[model samples]
Target chain A: MALDQSAQLSDDALLMLYANGDPGAASELTARLAPRLLPFCNRMLQDLAEAEDVVQESMLRLWKMAPDWVPGAAKPSTWLFRVASNLCTDRLRKRRGVGLEEIAEPADDRPGAEAQLIQAERLSALDAALQTLPERQRQAVVLRHIEGMSNPEIGEILEISVEAVESLTARGKRALAAALAGRKEELGL
Target chain B: MTGPNDRIDEFELDALFEEARGESPTPSDDLVARIVQDAAQMQPKPASSEGHEPTGVFRQFLAAIGGWPALGGLATAAITGVYIGVAQPGLVGVTAAELEDLDYVSTEIWPSDDLFFEEG
Candidate 1:
């Protein structure tokens, strides 16, 4: 199928096409999914290179899974996010010994006006605060607030009950609020 | 003792989250390229023609006849029969030329020269 036509296809359809060896399907899926997964992984891992690796590996797994993917069993994006979320969790576990001071700041390469800079600073502070959260809480918060996913969907991704998801996000927000307590005036919030 | 002023309010937190949502990082071109490459590498190969059942009537008929090998054997037998008929090979102890020179006559079931037949 042509790229434009495949773009109209659902993730499941694209995956079926990919399984059927449609060359355009892989590209279409990459275009559709990578951006969404990248930031989620980045927010979870807080390392661009590591996040990129996780996203690539997750996508590779998706490609491998295409042949066995039952269309109606689950949404492809949901499955992809679940895989990525787990991968980020594993990486975070491995970095358990690392100190918080070693966590690299998000690269700010964009040239913008003062207001844009302030917005970037606020976002950076939020990201740092997110990194301080426990892995599950961070995943829940990012999926809920940052990724704007529904609570049930976040629960599905995190393999937790919706109530648990709400609890985590609630606690996560409180932690973030406390973490950024003194920065309200500094961040122009 | 934590003071009320020390903590960011829910309104402020929500604004921060909104800003963070707006700052989603894009996957770099190189990363996308690598991911596309990985997908292409890991993709399942297309289902081959051998895996599909024969569809058309002719194809089904061919399958019923045991496929190409059976058809080849049938063709060979046909061609050999035609060769023996046209070329008149002498393997059967008689040739077309010899059959042409031979005479065939009708024989009666009862001969009138028999004495019992004359009396009857």
Candidate 2:
């Protein structure tokens, strides 16, 4: 039997292969990491279109950095998230007047029929509150809370101490709760 | 506060993180595909080699130009001369007599100091 992914080849191993010019490794990394990055970017930019742009740019950066990518130096997912965070922050700073999307826009325009009517408002509120967070806190929360990276892993990706990641995530969660707490009825959850 | 402090252990924070993470919204397949396509196209080029160049007369010339400062200065001077040669006379186009008469009706640029500096 072929070995399972986590046992046969971890992300770092695949990353090493990618650094050595394995196209398959690159595709595998893309397939695995894209899902995690999409939500993280959507949370930060709040506009689905802009979030898509940031994630694309970030992945391009990762590919460019792959040749010199030190194996075991970073988890591919963590690195992608960090790069995506930085990209979104750049847009947030540069794009004047851009803000969180309004929570009430109907989700009918999207192609996927996956937008659940029940959790629609709650999810939108959560997205809006996430958009309002400070860039670093938002990054820390997304990597830690959303991506489930360890504190140390986040610390490495963020170039900070584990304690700092912890502190940032805690403060971020509090801010998110405060921002979304008052909108229960409108959020419907 | 029962925040991520002494009261609330890292495990609790970790658990909440896991729970919250599970609520992640899926991205449209189209979006992921577009981004991945861009990424696949953006594979970084391998570093180029500047070393081990074939030695030749041009290489010897470059070597001597640096070794002899005067030659280096002469090369720069020649380059500057060529630039000036191409550029200086470009301003002195010979307009046809009728064209000049039509154009020069206002400005006294034929053979006067105003041609050099007007509106004194």
Candidate 2 is scored at a TM of 0.57
TM-score on B-chain, cand. 2: 0.23
Where is the poorest 10-residue window by lDDT in model 1 chain A? A107-116
Identify the runs in model 1 with alpha carbons over 4 angstroms from their true place: A98-101, A105-117, B48-120
By DockQ, the best candidate is 1
> How high is the TM-score of chain A in model 2?
0.77
As for candidate 2, its clashing pairs are: none
TM-score per candidate for chain A alone: 0.90, 0.77
Q: After superposition, how far is residue A117 of candidate 2 from its true place, in Å?
A: 9.0
Model 1, span A65-163: residue lDDT tens: 899999989888999999999898877777777755566654333345243346657777788788778888999998988889999888888888999
lDDT for position A140 in model 2: 87
Question: For model 2 chain B, where is the 10-residue window of minimal lDDT?
Answer: B1-10
